[model samples]
Target: MGAAFITPGEIIENSSNLTPGKGTIEHEGKIIAMVQGNVIIDSKSNTVSVKNDDEMPTPKVGDYLIGVVDRLGEKAATIKIIQIEGDGRSILPEHQYADIYVAGIVDRFLPAPVDAMRRRDLVRVKVTETNPVLKVNTRDDENCGVLSALCPQCGEDLYAKPEGDKNVHCPQCDYSGYRVLSNGFGQGYNLEKNGAAAYNRLKQRWSKEFDEIFKAGIPARSVLLRADHRFDGRKITRPNFEGSGGNNQRKERPKGTKLFVGGLARSIDTEKLKEIFSKHGDVIDAIVMTDKETGNSRGFGFVTYSGKASAEVAIKELHKFDLNGRKITVNNADDKSSSKREKKPSGKKIFVGGLDWNVNEKQLEKLFSKYCKVIEVSIPLNRDTGKSRGFGFVTASEDSADKAIKALDGFELNGRKIGVRESENKSKQKNNKNQRSTRELQARREEGIED
Candidate 1:
């Protein structure tokens, strides 16, 4: 019969009549192949076995190994075993990897494996177990530790510094840190001459400064911090004085016209805003404020004219003006703060709901104007459609507010019965003091710019 190709863990013989041979083991009275090869049944010897022509050497216990750190975790680190010490034979592909846990890093207590070695560090380790998985130890021998390593903060060579808090220090950046160092650490120090005494001179405990920094977290260093000094050919220069190169200072001119344009259509851009406002006066600057993300219009913008007369005319003619089939609001951009300082509006704000989409600020103002002198009327519109949100706010004298609420609470206007009441919101004048825009405007005024 032709020999059958067998693989590891494959049953070769089911009876005890055949004894297990090399590359095979007996389990439960069955002969199992331990390697991938052709099964040989020796009838004369009454034995079965499997054999492979090629087999790579694997490390045994108590053998020293040279490897590089591959991965680091909080509890353990993986090492890629390269060569078995004093053995030039290559390791089997399946056994090329090993691991060294935090407890195996040093005799002293370590918080993590990184405190001893980092990835890509060349290390010498002693094999501890090789059956289920390869395990190595760095603290077993003084010579079995990191032979070469780079600084964690700065990518420079680390020198052994037994005198400092850590075993290693970077000469360029003055960064000191610890490592499970070998006797032959840095520049290939002769272990025979060094006598492995330096390896045992580990600090008994972490210093107070190191403990604090470790608890606080590792500090990050950037290449830009040392770029200017490292590279002399391309040096970056900084401005010696404040407001240099026209960065911090705005161009000075007469207090020109600045108008706040609200209720702008979503499709409008800076060019469209400039085109529409040009008819009023020479448009020095026009902008349509947009969302930082999405780049869509914010339903409000600012416009600047060369002269204040042009601005006053725009506010008069364009307030509640219709453009793009939507009614808009126009007011002096600087008037909000100025009006509060000059004369605080004395009134109680009344909320009006169930407003028809057709209703506007003019209609609302006229309705409340009959009861008392209306201080201001605000009908917030949907930013997208530029349509009224079916509600508005009106400011009137306290006595007039009661009269208006009683009269207009259920009064039908343009087909909808409106709901009216004393606004629950506090005075906007007091709230404006805490607004971000108001704070920015106050800052700009404090920068020596006139209204």
Candidate 2:
């Protein structure tokens, strides 16, 4: 063979025949291949070597690189190298990832990578090392740092703002923030100015605004931390922060009395909700659920009254009542029954249908408990919204099942008559094609009306 294929640790030739070179190593009395490649025999030097079939070009010291901010830490940032400047060859897979420390971002003191560059920012850096690990730097470089970035708030393209307190400004939103800017920022690859020199001309030290907003020692002054009035369409409403009682200890309320308030407008918050429900009786607590990422209302909440009678009054009066252009629903919060707890198949079960969206499992149990000894109650809920599916199952004593069904069937609760009957095999309904829950059907009907 002109050149033989070899694998790592495979014997290539005797040590006396061919001296070890490159991918080959001398072992005992043999020249062994150290890597998987094609074996090469150097005739002039009389040495054996291996050549990789798929070798890739790597970045060298002093070479500039283009990358995106992949991950961040308190002291450093991980950059995923996208392109090597002035080079057409691709980088090796193992050498594509690089790290840029806080010190390498700029000469000034940076608390973390977030202050200098955010995730998904396009940055330019100079390679400082290629072995052991890829290391890059942006310090004192006019062409380095962020080339392009989007506004963190409104997702609009940010423009260079040298005159503002922050280095970048969003045209579509009121977001102004700092970044380790490059000479080519907002200009793509065509750079005409020295960014580092311009940055040096501005205030070199940290400003008071920066200290209050991001510094650890001072209280957070970011707009995100404050409860401000948010505008929706033409309406304006402010979100409620839980009262400050020194510590965050919640007040004690009777168990199994929490109420679910649904179909609320996005503008409604705890304060407004409490104000509307407080007329019935003393409201212990009220909470409006909000999105974790965006900090916006999810249009539903929970309320706790001082007594069950007050809870019933709130539900009866507020369910299907209009507030802020929406028909809100109020009912008992779902909870496991505190009555006789028995395993499955221990009692007679009944199917309850035509339930109001406000009705919860606890309410169903309470209704059945009046006629018979309740064993357990189950009401399926929407996984995404945690709202009632408007139906439930109740298990009761054998003798009381028929009596309870007879008395409770067609009973008016929350302005709607509910159907209660012996439990049937629901597996067929589950297998039925194109079947949707009551809420889904209602949503689809509403969508059709809009169209």
Candidate 3:
């Protein structure tokens, strides 16, 4: 049998002349012997082989290989697989592994070649075809390989379209390109021009998609549920402001207790007013009227307490209370005289004084409209002159008349103080006084005759 030519690292033992064509010798533990032809001797395993000096070619399947992405298209990534490593005499030749085609780079989402593979991400790949090796005429022609186009603007998928005459433009960002180079994948390549615009388009698309996905999964009702649950199980109890509780309770007044709060600064709001009155007793309600349009606080407001005792306490403590830089008056509302108070009178007519001369019945009606319905505004006219005397009587229902008197008594009109007094018959009062005097004189005459 012909001996195989041994390469370096072949175990030889005790041999002196270890040349290519030598005789039998032992160097380390293995035997080195000269054979007739090219063959390998496995001294340890007792196997003989023929020497095959042919070098292995590079390309192989299932081997991790580095290549530049040359021509990236919408449907595929074209890789020019350049370098290969393997035996020269294999069933599948190494040269045949060049110029591989990988499809669906644009349609499917994949990480950039530089990103390290992560467990969370899926790396899917398919090998389509291996091209036959062909002899190239020129070295410069070898550089004309596929290049993958990555959007220079947004780092997203970019499509190619023919530009005006000689160039190709990226459909995504209008980036124009003409040159091609190898991508890392050996097939995909980026266009020489307009890479920036392409990247920008990709970035925008990616951002929009991300935002939509983020918003779609968020629950709208979660916020409301959280707020409601914050106050769950809380309870509050308060005595009824108007309901009777015990025999000691004073006869329920026909009129509810009226609380006059005076010490509020114009800045005090209804809430603050209520808080102040609540200290004295349970307050039914507090209202601070304001100009609807302006939203400025009016100087005065009303607070109704739960009972007369609370109302009295509030009036005493808060009457002179200093609120918002002002002292306010708090007191019991006064009752009007019977004749002036009666809204519907049998024959009584009260005089309203200190009216402006220009004021008319309609003007008076509008002023008192909130409190009562005015039946008349009779301004006494002089028999000699048809002009008004600047005063008028307002006749309303008995109930409303009293309300009007109470509301309007201290009100200022036309820079003058107004007075509302009970109307009486002057002649009847005078006659009654005279008759009482005559009866007294007759009683004295009878006493003298008896004496």
- Candidate of highest TM-score: 2
Cα lDDT tens digits, model 2, 108-157, are 76767667787778988999988889999888778888999877665678
Q: Quick one: best lDDT, which candidate? A: 2
Q: Once all C-alphas are superposed, what RMSD does model 3 give against the true structure?
A: 39.8
Please, what is the whole-model Cα lDDT of each candidate in the order they appear?
A: 0.75, 0.76, 0.45
Instruction: List the candidate 1 regions with Cα displacement exceeding 4 Å.
Output: 1-55, 187-190, 193-200, 217-451
Instruction: Give me the runs in candidate 2 sitting further than 4 Å from their true place.
Output: 1-55, 195-197, 200-203, 216-451
Using lDDT as the measure, name the better of candidate 2 and candidate 3.
Answer: 2
lDDT assessment of candidate 2: 0.76
Per-prediction count of colliding residue pairs?
A: 0, 0, 65
Q: Which segments of model 3 are wrong by more than 4 Å?
A: 1-255, 334-451
Point out the higher-scoring one by lDDT: 1 or 2. Answer: 2
Question: What order do candidates take by TM-score, descending?
Answer: 2, 1, 3
List, residue by residue over 67-117, the lDDT tens digit for candidate 1. 989877667899999888777767765578998898898887677776677
Against the true structure, candidate 3 reaches a TM-score of 0.20
lDDT for model 3 comes to 0.45
The candidate with the higher lDDT, 1 or 3, is: 1
Kindly report the root-mean-square deviation of model 1 from the true structure over all alpha carbons: 18.2
